[model samples]
Target: MIKPLSMIIFGQDAEQRSLTRMQLISGGKVNVVAESSDYAHGLDLVKRYNPDSALLITNGKSEASLDLAKQLAKEHPSTVIVCTGTNCLTETVIKFFRAGASEFLMQPPSQAEMKEVLEKIVAARATADQNKQGEAVIACYSYRGGSGSTTLSVNLAATLAHTFEKPTTIVDLNLQQGTAPIFLGVKPVYSIADVAHNQDRLDAQLLKSFHTPVSDNLYCLASPLKVEEADDVEPSHIELLLSLLRGQFAYVIVDCQHFIDATTVAALQQADTILLVTLLDMASIYTTKRTLEIFHKMGLGDDKVRIVVNRYVKDPDVPLDKVEQVFGHRIHLMLADDYRAALSALNLGSPLVSSQPKSPLVKQYIELAHKITGREATPKKGWKGGFSFFGK
Candidate 1:
């Protein structure tokens, strides 16, 4: 069950070079049917075909090849890259790896070497697809304070990363009062403050350097501990940051500020779904009402927002119907009361979702995540087709 691999090449001689390269790659059994020649054209091909690998003949001293490789790698992190060039100097080889090349074949490479390189890059593609399938995003936001937004965001991000073998980031955009690092018990050398201060210098490599990895796949960019030491991050800054993050993590969950500031608004717009968390109380309900009204004006519809009743009870002073009636909307999800356990989990820097996946609370979140992703409401149920083997 072998799938045809998509391949792209760099420069004007794309057709001739890529075709010849494809001959070696196909080995007649495997199809190296897809190819692209130049950097701009390669981007279009990669976006359209989603190539498994891009075989680059590194243009003699210029970084045209390296630059193209970096762009493709960022878009399709799983897409392997193989470089063929005489200029495979020590520094240049390091650059290729940094740009996400799986293997580099020097100019006048051997048939055995080419075959070996092709196999390695293709194998990497298979591994990457498997990893991508297992990823999911958990978004943590609140309708009001004291409903435990920070606690939930920190724990939830950690849960996905540590428990599921998925890469996750706990982004603390609370900005002024964010407590993400405090909860995770980590002291990041650079925080969102630095990112804001150095927006012009923000790039893939620098952003990676700023992230404090909480676990193998779990990382965090906590808030600036000092509230005032900041430049007001613009909407563009947030847009660029989140766009970059979509590629880096299986889940990019932010502990969002309750208010719709420039940053929060940007986050909400880009979110796959928004979990509007609240407890069954008057103050929260009132605040939720105001926020929804504001969102309505901005056109963030009901379809995008999921109301989560955190710390809920079967019966409460405020009934679900009455509460919904007040807001003129239905209650979408409910998590049972477990204040002590939630607090303990937050304090210990462990997420209830991971430690207690089957807990009523955890189950509710899992269900919501499934629904948001358009996966089956039933958890084990998967994508429409049965998992593909080789020739789908």
Candidate 2:
């Protein structure tokens, strides 16, 4: 049995609103969660309830109805908009669609037509949920600075974009001091702050406009340009932005801030895989342990949170087995220590995957990307071993 669609009705005329609600609820195909004759109150109810559909009755005020439809489509993309009006002219229907209405029904809507629309919405939502399950959101996070989370995020995004040949975006969540744009060698005209500020009017097209194109398939949603702008961002905004991006991009990579905050927690919670990056030093290990405890408290387990050791060297003092024994969890991956190559790439303002493809560090990144995608890493020619698996 299909789940009944939740809907909200908005109309200036109380009589029309009541009639529409009655028809919608007759067959039990639609559940009228709220009904409002006032536009402001209707908008508030939609935000509060976040219903599956919004039914706008265009009685005397067509312009106002269209405006409401447009606003709802931009702010709540998941909610399907259906407009009913007396004037079902060609131009009138076109205007509704342009304003983001999915379906148009004449005044005194038929139960059959409304039922058809509800069925379509349910089927469409099912397909969208399946697609979302296939998409991946990978977040690179650390509790201490200089753990190289940003570098890992940028290079991994680049490799995923190149390997999959699909659209991939790396979001810089280190609002105050984000450098993902610098690492990618692009100066973005807009930042995540812009997205938050204009969230009321944000849609897929508007979001694409804000992205700074790094490559054919790679894009960057930069951090705030001014440090003060970071204050304007909220956890709710991060959640909304990521949800929208998930629908548009094949992969979303988030470079989270070093410290734990509400905003960072928001991103971590949304991620399908959280790469807990850290160094092999005792201090860094302790910080990572604390972070793991916090994550455990947050209901994130070892399955979602994978520890990655960056800038790793084969130090006898800090053996991999001992670190695993201490944490009671295995380290997921270890990136080789290559200060010269990393510094050179930074100077060139490019990821090592692109600046120095032959570097071993780049191969490890490729391997990591392949592992995330559940594919075997391709072996490089002239190398005795295919690819080193330090995690093994």
Candidate 3:
């Protein structure tokens, strides 16, 4: 049985607060931990209780409620901020979403509406708890450039999020040429450097707010916006950031830089699984061998580091067996070669799963995610029709 959702109510109307509390309690799915008419006191209650959800009542005219909601969201990222108001204007809903509110409801919401919201929160919590044993950190690295490490990192994270319904984050460690933000089509206001500068005060909640949300379950922590800002980030910052991300997300995917550096080493050390991405060519094979040797020196076993050959063709000049023989390690996975599909997705500023769900490349990514998570694949809705090159 699911436990009742712990909630706190903050509103200026005492009568409205009481009514809301009674309504929630009648459903037997919400336990109102605290309620206050005073915004400051209610905010204090939220911080104290750290409830599952916070319901802010607004009457459209007051900025006080909105301000309280924003503060709660920033300070308590784990808590679901639900904005309830009589004014359901499109602009009002958009404003709350921009303020970081997760859900919105009409004032004195009906029993059915309230129940639906509570169920959504409970379901999300249950999914999170399912993976609470420990977070899995998967770092994608490539010793040679143009091996599609970034592309793999982005799509793999997206597959885990959209297909597997897992909470996942992708960190862009390619500091100088990071294109994660562009791939996800988001203009981030904060970057890894910003988080590093505030590392002393960083917590899971603060770190959660720093990332840009790519979808409901996926987020991206972009590299430094300015080229020189990369210098501000140190190896220790990467370690601290990964630690906090593990606490908040089920899976953390790091797009490591091509060359070995202090920062990349820090990320690799924390990774539970390392995907050494390479292409099916002699150059990539030679680099993979050297990289494997380095991993052995770093005490990362072959079991921990998996080789993934990207842009694989049907009959490569260098056969799979010969490549595996050179590295003395089996190629864990080989993704299909579809340059047009990949380039189209990149140009569209979207993940392959979103832009070309039916593409063989997307299917391979789904298989990769299943291999990582050890979960069975479920068929996605609206995916039985003819294939289209673009999502349009």
The sequence of per-residue lDDT tens digits that candidate 2 reaches over residues 259-356 is 88999988887787899999988899888888888988887767877888999889998899999877767888899999888877766667777667
Model 2 has how many clashing residue pairs?
0
lDDT of predicted model 2:
0.82
Off by over 4 Å in 1: 1-139, 353-360, 373-392
* CA lDDT of every candidate: 0.66, 0.82, 0.82
Give the candidate order by descending lDDT.
2, 3, 1
Q: Could you give the candidate ranking by TM-score, starting with the highest?
A: 2, 3, 1
lDDT for model 3 comes to 0.82
Give me candidate 3's TM-score against the actual structure: 0.65
Candidate 1 to truth, TM: 0.61
Clashing pairs in 1: 1-390
State the displacement of the C-alpha of residue 374, model 2, in Å, after optimal TM-score superposition: 1.9
The C-alpha stretches of model 3 lying farther than 4 A from their native spots are: 1-135, 379-392
Structural RMSD, model 1? 14.2
Mark the regions of model 2 whose C-alpha exceeds 4 Å error after superposition: 1-134, 376-392
lDDT-better candidate, 1 vs 2: 2
